[model samples]
Target: MTDQWVSFSKVGDAELVSLTGEIDLANSGEIGKAIVGRIKESGKVLIDLTTVSFLDSAGVRLLDALVGDLLGHGARTRLVVGERGAARMTLTLCAFREDVLTTDLERAAADLK
Candidate 1:
């Protein structure tokens, strides 16, 4: 669809990155770059997927890779998902086992503590 969109904001000690539009092969690297750039600066990242309309395999791969990079750097990552569909499904299918991603911000923050 339209070019992929990602916006960033801060919530307490967490950095929230809100992603929109379709995430596919063409834009997944951009997404990764934006996120990694933020993590390099702050080392704490949260991905808010409340508005993501679609997600493809490349998107999932990017997310998975980012999670690994974040964890390897001793940074924290969280995922806040709204509603349920392909984006959530793809996340579950690709990134569920890492224990680095979470749907609840409070819980994630507590765990980080």
Candidate 2:
């Protein structure tokens, strides 16, 4: 499935998936599945949430599951959640690991090294 909010690229050895716009109940499932289907989990990955403007409960759950699935499959995953960005508070409230979140895209990529 093609999602307008999702785009894929590569940064060094990591696969970069940048998400834009809002991610809510209506689209989070499809988005999560699309990502899981497209990414090979044996390497490094960076999920850039910096451009996301909204992250609802379903979106948080999608990210939590996606990150867990990737790590379980031996992939190192990092999330680019800017400190003052829209997704940050929701992630913080959901108690996502601080180590997995970063405010910079470059930092997210570097962490994969």
Candidate 3:
């Protein structure tokens, strides 16, 4: 994908940061920064990893760190994971707690609303 291709998008009241291509060590910090910046702008953030083709340990760590930072900033965060191979693997490996990261965006938004 081109560098100009944004892996993120702000949709409605939620900032949807999509992870496309490979999320390895090189782009993990960038992804974290993008998410953090969006969180700073809006209290609500949703990470959509539906298009993510691959994720390494570095990517997972970055996501975990981002979640912690968002929590520290008192921002609400949710993760919308696609029901596929890499995306499913990432979610399962993360083992994210429901109180921290939610799987459904609509339910999360309703709760937040």
Candidate 4:
């Protein structure tokens, strides 16, 4: 269920979801679903993509939907994307909101406040 590619942790008051390796059509759905389940009961969430090696349209869509869902629930949420990662490049190309993207885990958690 994408366990090999996805991992979870607690970052301050935020539930952190980290991804490694590629996030393409084959595993994006599973990863997204799993993350949704994780943050459903959380008050804040952080999506960390610093270690993600690759991303595609599916991954972008998943992030969009995830952020939308979290916002809808009034949950504080942020994304952790290193300045030079594939995930960051893809998200930038897709015009993903910069207000939600950051490069530090602690900063992301602080932003949730």
Q: Number of the top candidate by TM-score?
A: 4
Residue 79 of model 4 has an lDDT of: 90
Computed on alpha carbons, the lDDT of every model, listed in order, comes to: 0.73, 0.88, 0.68, 0.89
Q: Against the hidden true structure, what lDDT does model 4 obtain?
A: 0.89
Q: In candidate 3, which residue pairs get closer than 3 Å at backbone N, Cα or C atoms, i.e. clash?
A: none
Best of the two (1, 2) by lDDT: 2
Error of 4 at 97 (Å): 0.9
lDDT of 3 at 37: 59
lDDT of 4 at 49: 93
- Model 1 alpha-carbon miss at residue 45, Å: 1.2
Tens digits of per-residue lDDT for model 4 on 1-113?
A: 67889899997777989899999999988998888877798889998899999999999999999998898888888999987989999999999999899988888888888
Worst 10 residues of 3 by lDDT: 1-10
If ranked by lDDT, best first, what sequence of candidates would result?
4, 2, 1, 3
Worst 10 residues of 4 by lDDT: 32-41
Q: What TM-score would candidate 2 get against the native?
A: 0.94
- Candidate 1 at 55: error in angstroms? 0.7
Error of 1 at 61 (Å): 0.8
Any residue pairs clashing in model 2, and if so which? none
Report model 3's TM-score to 2 decimal places. Answer: 0.77
